[model samples]
Target: MASPACAATVSGAPFAAMDFPLQPRRPTPGQRALAEALARGEAMMGEGIEQLPAATYTDPDRFAAEMRLFRTLPQLVAPSALLPEAVSAVAHDGYGSPLLLTRGADGRAHVLANACRHRGTRLVDGDEVVGAKRIVCPYHAWAYKPDGELSGMPRAECFPGFDRSANGLRAYPSAEIGGLLFYAEDEQADFSDLRALEPDFDAFGMAGLHLYERRVHDVAANWKLIVDAFLESYHVQRLHAQTIAHFFADGITVADRVGPHQRAAVGRAALLERADLDDMASLRRAVTFTYALFPASIVVVSPDYINLLVCMPQSVGRTLVEDYMLIPEPPQTNEAAAHWQKSWALLDGGAFGTEDFGAAARCYRGLASGTIETVTLGTLENGIADFHRRIDAALAR
Candidate 1:
C-alpha cells in the first residue's frame, strides 16, 4: 500500500498512527429528533417560522466562535474524488486558515499545514505544485519531502536537538474513501473508528475516477452561507428557473449519519417518467446524489462525472471555494476531452455558476445588515438546516 520511501518511514515508526474512534452504529437522540423533524417537514417549515438566529451567520463574535469550532472540534471534513492523489487539509494561523493538499507518486494522500514549520510561509500557493515529491519553501530555502520529512535544513548545527527525524511537517488525521479523503486537524481528537460513516465508494460511485476540471471561486460570502445555498433544491423552481430548473425537482429527501456527513436526494422522476427525456438516454443516469461530507465539502455526483465543492473560510465575510469536476477515468481522446469541457462550461456558465453565486452574495449582504434576524430553512432545505444545527452543537461543546 506504500512506496519504498513511505514504507520505510512508517515502518516501526514511533509516531502514533492515526486511530479514529469508531462511532456507534446507531444514530443519537439528537439525530433521531432532527430526522423526525425533517420527515414531518416541521423544523424548518411554515409561514412565520422562527428563523435560525441571524447572529449565527452574521455577527463577528459568532463567526469567530464558529472558526474556533471548525479548527478545534472533532468533526470530520469529507473526502474528495482526488483522495488517492490529493489529501486536502485545512489549518489556521494568525491571518486565516488555508487548505493544503498533497499526493505522492504512490497515490497516497496527505493534508498538512500549508505553512512552512520554520518561518510560517505557505508551502502551497495554488494547484501548480501538485504531484511533486519535493516542496521547497518559497520564502526560505527550507526544503521538505512529500511525506512531511525534512531532508535538509540550511543551518543544521546551530539549532541544538533539532532532530530532522522529529521535525516532519504536521499531518492532520486523514482517511480515503471512494476516491475522496476525509480529515480533521484536532491532535487530541480520536478518529480511529469510522464505522458510523462507512466507506461508501460504491454508493457514491467514485472508484476509477479521474480529474476533469477545477473551478476556483473567490466567493464574497461566509463559507456556511455558500454551503447553505447548495444544500437545498427549493430554489430550483424559482431562482434557477433559467437554467437547471428543467432538470431538477421541487422536493428533496435527506439522511444523516452520526457525524456531520449527510446525503440529500432530489427527485429525478420528473425527467425519468416524463416523455421530454425520451430522446435523452443519459437522463436515466440516476437521481441526483448530493453528499455533504462532514464539515465543509459537498460531493455532487451524476451519471457522467462528480462535481466537488469545497468551502474554505477566508475571513469573517469572505470564502475561497475550490470546485472540481471529475470523471470516472481519464479521457482517452480529444473528442472526449471536448465533450467534458463542453459539459463543464455549460454547468459553470449557466445556473450552477452565476445564479448560485449571485444569490448567495445577495443573501450574505442582507445577513450582514441587522434587518434580518433569522433565516428560515424549509423541509427541502433540511440538509442545510441540519448542517447549521450540527455546526452550532459542535461549537457549543
Candidate 2:
C-alpha cells in the first residue's frame, strides 16, 4: 500500500514525521513477523557470537577468491526503468566488467561485453543512454543489432568465414524483473533463486519508479566491510545519532534470506501502536525495509523513495559504490526537484558517505594494520554473521 507519513522518535529528543507518497508494496509474512516481534518488545537474539579471522578481509589469496565468487554470481545492475524502451543501450563500468546493457525489440534485457567483436574495440562509450537500433563499432563501423546480432561490416567478404550470424558480441546471462536488471559474468549462472525477490520488487512498484539521481563513492575499504555496515542496526543508534538514530527502534531488526540474498526490516517504537497490517500510514511511520542483494547490491526502502547501492571491490582495501536514488515519478516542478535534491544530499553525502562508509574505511585500516586478530560479531549482528557464512560457502565452492 502507499506509505503514509514517516516518523522517527528518540528518547529526550523531539519526534519527527515526513509526508511523501511512496509507491505501495504488499506486506509479506516476513513483515508480519517483524510487526509482531516489535509488539512483543523483544531484544534481538541469534545463535550467539561468531568470530572471523581478520585475514578474511585482508588476505590477498582470500581477495582473489572473493572476486571469483562475485563474478560467478548474479549482480544487480540498475533499475530496468533506466532502459525502459524496447531498443535502448547504456554503458556501465562499475560491475568490474565494462558492459553494454541493452533491451531489444523482444523486450528482453541483454548484458554484453562493451568491446566490439572486431579488435575488441569499445562499441559504445560514456554513460549516456543510447537509443540506436544498431551498435556500430567506432573503429571499423561493423554494425550489430541491440541483441548483439551482427548485421554488416565495412567489407562483407574480407573477414575469415564472413558469417554474421555467428559473429555477434560475446554475452553473459541476463534478466529483467519488476523493472530491475541483473546479470552474471558466468553465462551458465542459474537465476531461479532470484524469483524470490520479484514479489517484493513488485510491491515497491520498482518497475515504474523514476531515476532521481545517481552518485558513486570510491572509498578506502574492503567491499564486504561496506555491506557489513548495512547488515545490522547495532551502530544505527550510536553512529547515526545526529542523523537517523531517532528514526528507528534500536536493536530490533528482523532478517531472513533467500538463497544468498537477504531481506531485513527494523521498526520504530510507534510500531507497537500500528495494530492493522493494512494501515499504510502507521506501517510507513513504524517500519523501514532493506534488501541486501548479495555479492554486490543493496536496496533500501526509505520513507518516500528507494536507494539502490552496488558495491564493487577493487582490491583487499578499496571499493567503489554506485548509489542510485529512485522516486515514484519524475519531478514536474521546482519544489519537487528540491524535495528529492534535499533527500539525496542528506543520504549521499551525510548518512551513507560520512557515517556508514566512513566507519567501514576506518575499520579496514585497523584490520589491514594487523591490530585485530579476528572480527568479532555479537548476537545482535546476526545478519552480518549470516553474511560471512554465505561468503565462506561460496569461497569453499
Candidate 3:
C-alpha cells in the first residue's frame, strides 16, 4: 500500500498530490540569513546593473576555461542506484571522458576510465552492462577486472617488460554521498565542500529512488546558458505558461546559498488557501525545490518524482544535456506505470525539453549575434546571478 502522502491527491486529481513525503529540514545559519533577506524584500529588488558580457557565452577560450573548472571540481555524476548490484556497470558519456561506473564483486562502487589501457578504445558503448565478470575492449580484447585492474592482454610475450598491474584502468577520485556518485579529475579532490552544501540530502531518500527514464538532448547553446534556464522561475510565467505556469506562483521564488551551491523554491499558488501552512508537511506540498549544484547539475524535486539535468559542454556554442527522471520505486501496476508515463510526457517532453531548452537555443543565437553586451538579472532572478558569480569565482582560481 502507498503511504498516505503518496496516495494523497489535490481535490481528486490523479497526479496532483497535495503532500510530499520529503520535507525540508531546519534551515542553517546561511539559510536563515537568506530567509530574513527575502522577508525584508532585499532579494526581490534588482542587484543593480549586473552584466555578464555576451562574449563569455560565445568565446572559445572562456568555454575551455569552464571545461577546465569542471575537470578540477568535484561533480555529481549519477545516483548510486544506477549500479544496484555487484558486477553491474553503466556507461556515461556526458563528462569530458567516457566513464564506466561499476559495483565490484566486493560490493564497492568504482568509477573507471572507460577507455582501454591499450589503444585507448572505449570498452562499452551501451548504457548498461549486467552480470559482467570482466570488461573486454572490443578492439584488442584487453581484459580488466571489475575493480579496474588489468587482468589480461591478447599476447603477453609480444611486449618486453610489460607490467599488467601498471596498465589498469585509470580511476578518478569518487565518492557516494547522500546516494549520489561524484567524481573529479583530481584524484585527491575534496568532496567535503560539496557534501556540506546539502547536509540534509540523505533525508530525501535519493539512494533508494530508482531511475525511471533517461533522455539525452543535444542543445545548440552554451552549457552555462542551459544551466541558467533552471536557476530562476522568472521565465516560467512567459515561456512555460502553457505547461507549468498554472502550477506555480508568478515570480515568487526564494533562493538560499550554501557555499557556491544554491537552493531555490517556487511556491504553488494552489497552496495559499491551505489552513495548514504552518506545518512542514503542508509547506513542502506547496512548493517545488530546485538545487543547482555548483558547476553544471540541476536537481528539481516535485511531489512525486525528481528530475536531474546535467549539462556537458561540447563547444562554446554546443552542449549535451542528460536528463534523468527518478521515482521512489518501480511501478508495480499498469495504472501506476501509465500515470508516470503521462506525467513524464507532459513535464519532460513539453515543459523541460521543448519549452525550456528550446528557448535556450534561441537565446544562444541572439547572444552570439553580439547585439547585447550583457544579460541582466532582476532581483527575482538572484539564483541566476549567484550561478554566474560562482562560475567566475571557480575560473578565477
Candidate 4:
C-alpha cells in the first residue's frame, strides 16, 4: 500500500509532522552556531571585502585549473535517493564521462563505465533507473552481472582463452556517504572529509527519502558563477522578490564550515521570539538550512522537502546542473501530488531556473566582455569568499 500522504500545513506552522519520516535530531555544534546567530538577528560576516578576478570565469587557463581540481578529486556521482534499492541501475552522463550506476544482489551501489568490456558498446541506453540484474550487450550479446562480472558470451569456444574474472567493466573508486555518492578516477583519494558529514546527513534523514523528480539544466555560465549564487542570501530580496524573498529577514544568513563544506542558516526572525528553541522540530520550522558541499553541490532544506543540485562545468562559459527534488515519500493521493507539483514548479521554475541561473548567465556575459576585472564580495557575502578560498587551496594541493 502507498504510504499515507504528508499532512497539510497545520495552523500557521511552517512544518507538518508527517513531512519528515525520521525523528528530528538536534542541530550539530556547528549548525547550532548558525541557529544561535539566527535567533540573535545577526549573521556571520567577512573581516573585509574579497575580490575575485574575472579571469577566474572567462580565461581558458583558469577554467582548466578548475577542471583539474575535479579530475584530481572524487566527484559526487548522484544522490543515493536516485537508486534507493538493490537490483537497480541508472545511466548518469552529468559528470562529463558516461557512467552506469548499478546496485547488485550485494545491495550496494557501484559506479561502472557505461561500455561493455567485450566490444566497448554502450551497456545502458537511457536515463531511467533500471534493474541491472543482468545487462546484455546490444552490440555483441555479451552479458554481465550487476556487479560487472562477465556472465556470458555468444560462442563460448570462439575465444581460445578468455578469463571472465579479468574482463569486467572498469570501475571507479567510490563510496556512498550522507546520501551522496562520491567517486574518483584515482584509486587512492581520501574520503574522510566526506565521511565527516554523517552527523549532518543523519539529521536530514536523506538516505531513505524518495526521489520525486529530477531535471538536467544546461546553463550558459561558468560553473563557479552558478555556485556563487547559492553561497549568499543577499540577492534573494531582489532576485527572488516575487518568489521566496518574503520568507526571509533581510541581511540575515549565518554560515559555518564543516571541513571544506559550508553550512548556512537563513534567518527567520520569528525564531528569535520563540521560547521552544530546545525543540528541534520547532527550530527547524523557525529556520531553513542550506549546505554548500565542496567543489559544487548544494542541499536546500525547505519546510517539507529537499532540493539537491550538483553543478558540473562543461566549458569556461557553460555548466550542466543535475537537479533533484526529494521528499519523505512519494505522494499517495491527488491532493499530495498537486502540493508537491506546485512546490516543484515554484522552486525549479521561478526561484532557481529563472532567477538564480538567469543571474549567473548575466554575470558571465558581463565578465566575458572584459569590462569588469574583479567581482567583489561584501561582508554579508562572505560565504562565497570562503568557498572560493577552499577551491583555491584544493587546487594548490
Rank the models by lDDT, top first. 4, 2, 3, 1
Give the Cα error of residue 184 in candidate 2, in Å.
0.8
| Candidate with the larger TM-score of 1 and 3 | 3
Candidate 1 residue 307 C-alpha distance from true site, Å = 0.9
Compose the digit string of candidate 1's lDDT tens values, residues 187-211: 7655543444444434344555676
Output the TM-score of candidate 4: 0.92
lDDT of candidate 4 over 125-231, digit per residue (tens):
88899877888899989988888888998897998788988998888888998787888777787788778887777677778788999998889999998888888
Poorly placed runs, candidate 1 (over 4 Å): 1-50, 73-95, 98-100, 115-124, 137-142, 154-161, 190-198, 252-258, 270-284
Top-scoring candidate (lDDT): 4
TM-score of candidate 1 against the unseen true structure: 0.74
Off by over 4 Å in 3: 1-15, 18-45, 154-161, 268-283
RMSD, every candidate, angstroms: 11.9, 3.8, 5.3, 5.0
5: Cα error in model 2, Å: 18
For each candidate, the alpha-carbon lDDT, in order, equals 0.56, 0.76, 0.71, 0.77
lDDT of 3 at 130: 63
**Which model, 2 or 3, shows the larger TM-score?**
2
Enumerate clash totals for all models, in the order shown.
11, 2, 0, 0
